[model samples]
Target: MAVVKVDKKGRLVIPQEIRERLRIDETTPLIFEVDDGNTIRIRIIQRDDQAYTSDPLWKAIHNPVFIGKKVSKKELDEIENDQWSN
Candidate 1:
C-alpha cells in the first residue's frame, strides 16, 4: 500500500513499487470510474502482450469491446499473419 498526493492539476504519480508490482508503464492504459458517490475505482486493463504482433496490433487486440472474448489459436494466427489490404 502506498499514499499518493494528487497535484493541482488533478494528476498524481503512481509510486514505483506499485507500478512495478502491477507491471504498469507509460504504455499501460487505465480506466477510472465512480463506484458510488464517494468511492472511485481504478483498474489496469489487462492485455495479451505475448500475442501482440506490433504496437498497433496490441492496441487493437486489447480494445475494451473485445474483453471476455475467446479467440482460437487458428483465428489469431490468421489475423496476425494477414497483411494489410491497403
Candidate 2:
C-alpha cells in the first residue's frame, strides 16, 4: 500500500502507479463514501449514455414543458471531439 499525505486544502495526491493501473484521468468521475469512522471507500462511476436514454423515468419526463431534450448522435460525437479548456 502507498502512503500519502493530505495537503492543507484536504487534497491527497494519488500515486502515479495506482492511477495508471486504474486508467483514471482528470475527467474520471469518482464517488467517495465514509464506510466507517476510519475507513473510506472510493469508487469510479462509469456512465453509459445509452442506458440513460433508455431509462423509463427519462422517457416519462419527455413533456412539452420539460427543458431536457434528446441529444442527437451527431451532437454527441461533436461534443466528444471538442477540446475542453482548463
Candidate 3:
C-alpha cells in the first residue's frame, strides 16, 4: 500500500493509483458515516448521470416526500385495484 499524507486542511490526498482505481475526480461526492465506536468510514455517493426532463417519475425522485402516513395492505390493494380499473 502506498503512503499518503493528510494536508493541514484535514484533507488526505489520494494516491494516483488509488484515485484511478476508485475513479474519483474533483466532482465526486463523498459521504462519511461514523459507527457506534466513533470509527468514521467514507463512502462515495454515486448518482446516475442520465438527464431526463420529460419523465415525471424521474423528476419526483429529486423531490421525495415523507408524510409519516401509515399505509396498510388493504389500502395498497385498493389503490392497485383502482389503477387497474382505470
Best by TM-score: 2
Model 1: how far residue 69 lies from native, Å: 38
* lDDT scores of the candidates, listed in order: 0.77, 0.77, 0.76
Candidate 1 has a TM-score of 0.51
Per-residue lDDT of 1-86 in model 3, one digit per residue for the tens? 77667789988887888889999899786767887694667787666544333457857886776667988999989989998999
Residue-pair clashes per prediction, in order, are 0, 0, 0
Superposed by TM-score, candidate 3 places the C-alpha of residue 76 at a distance from the truth, in angstroms, of 40
Residue pairs in collision within model 3: none
The TM-score values for the models, in the order shown, are 0.51, 0.55, 0.45
What range of 10 consecutive residues in model 2 has the weakest lDDT sum? 58-67
RMSD of 1: 12.5
lDDT per residue for candidate 1 within 1-86, as digits (tens), equals 77788999999999998889999999887778999997778877766543334567666775645547899999878877785432
Q: Could you tell me the lDDT of residue 86 within candidate 2?
A: 19
**Which residue runs of candidate 2 sit more than 4 Å off their true CA positions?**
49-86
List ranges where model 3 is wrong by over 4 Å: 1-3, 36-38, 49-86
Candidate 3: residue 9 lDDT (0-100): 94
RMSD to truth, every model? 12.5, 13.8, 10.3
37: Cα error in model 3, Å: 4.3
TM-score of candidate 2 against the unseen true structure: 0.55
Residue 20's lDDT in candidate 2? 97
Cα lDDT of model 2 by residue, 1-36, tens digit? 899999999998889999999988897767789999
